[model samples]
Target: MIDLITAGLDWPVVVALLLTSCAASFITAAFGIGGGGVMLAVLASLLPPLAIIPVHGVVQLGSNAGRSVLFLRYMRWELFWPFAIGSVIGVAVGGMTVVQLDPGWLQIAVGAFILWTVFGKTPGIFKRSGPVAGAFSSFLTMFIGGTGPFVAAYVKAQDLERHSHVATQAVLMTLQHGLKSLMFGFLGFAFSEWAGFIAALIVAGFVGTWLGKHMLARINEKRFKLALNAILTVLSLRLIWSGVRLVFGI
Candidate 1:
């Protein structure tokens, strides 16, 4: 019944979340970096504060995993193990210090850096620092719950081709979200009650990702890069504003 699938939330809310999952996946699959933030914004409005990051992590794990599987062939194998190792270490550190530091200034710094990478001269360091990027973004995502843009900014700096860019980002995010989910489980979040709703969200995301792959194939690289940069610019600005608000206690 709708109640079971909604996990005691209203059916309309569940329906809205399902739709968001699909739409957010479509955007990320087609464009490469906006969907997780979109999904997080929507979930923040609908879910309780305590449930947001953990639930978002599970849903993102599913979304990115689907994209990773679909674009497996295009993944940059060289970066995987280093990023994975860094992510493991980062998550371990985040688990221990999740609540110690304030993330406000950190968000501002990340957003500004992303803007610089997109517009100004990108540091050569980014192209060689897969583990560092993975570790920093993974540690930050534990607090902000929306580090796809942070990771994407790094991926973009690599100057990868469109397919490789998307594929590699998907795989990296799958690892990050997977680790975050396990950490949340270790922290005692009850995922059982949300399983049915999360399943519905994942199924919707998969469907959207499948459809979006076709769109991605149609976009020329030049236009894809343009659109991606535009999206990143907007997202970075939003992040900056949020950090400003947090820091100023506005």
Candidate 2:
């Protein structure tokens, strides 16, 4: 069994993983969510349970780094500092504690949280923002690989234009994922073993981001946001279902 599993982790599998990363990155670049969560789901199914979080974190680091570079000019510096600081602290705690907890519950909680954020009716949900909100949301993101919806809500509350919204998210995600990768490394996740795979995914992510940028320019922002909401909704359901199955063994 062990040999079969290890053998399955060959070059062809690596290529498939990279392609998956590329597809996820493209969706994220275009719609601002789904990528990390989707990648996490796929990786969780393929890898040893122990390897899932760190491996997913590393790939996300590459993807978000590419995005941050592509959208560097639109980053809102004021919004960056608080979120970055909180994210660093939160990710450290999360990385240390995650393996000890019931991940199924965590997934359910995160999925429920996303659903609430997307469907809830609360005044000033997107109208109020500052260091406090940024820090809070960034802290939440540490437990979940992708917090694009939360970031988007905050940006929309601030009424940033399309470019600023996407760019700010790209920068924040870059910081979060970078710190996550570092934490995973500290935990002894072997990046060397997966270097080639990571490199391929990074290249694919760059290409996807480039393509997405063009698509972003041509689409109507409202329509894009609507589509994003739908994608997130479906992802949330999948997460919830996966968590339930894990907990129930059904």
Q: lDDT values of the candidates?
A: 0.92, 0.70
The residue-level lDDT of candidate 1 at 221 comes to: 96
Per-candidate RMSD, Å: 1.1, 4.0
Q: What's each prediction's clash count?
A: 0, 1
Residue 87 in candidate 1 has what lDDT? 94
Candidate No. with top TM-score:
1
* Clashing pairs for predicted structure model 1, backbone only: none
| 1-250 per-residue lDDT for model 1 (tens digits) | 6655898888789989999999999999999989999999999999999899999999999999999999999999998888898899888899899366776888798899889989998888776888888898889888888999988988898888999999999999999999999999998999998998998999999999998899999999999999999999999998898899999998
In candidate 1, position 96 carries an lDDT of 90
Tell me the lDDT of model 1 at 225: 99
Model 1, clash count? 0
Give me the runs in candidate 2 sitting further than 4 Å from their true place.
Answer: 1-8, 122-159
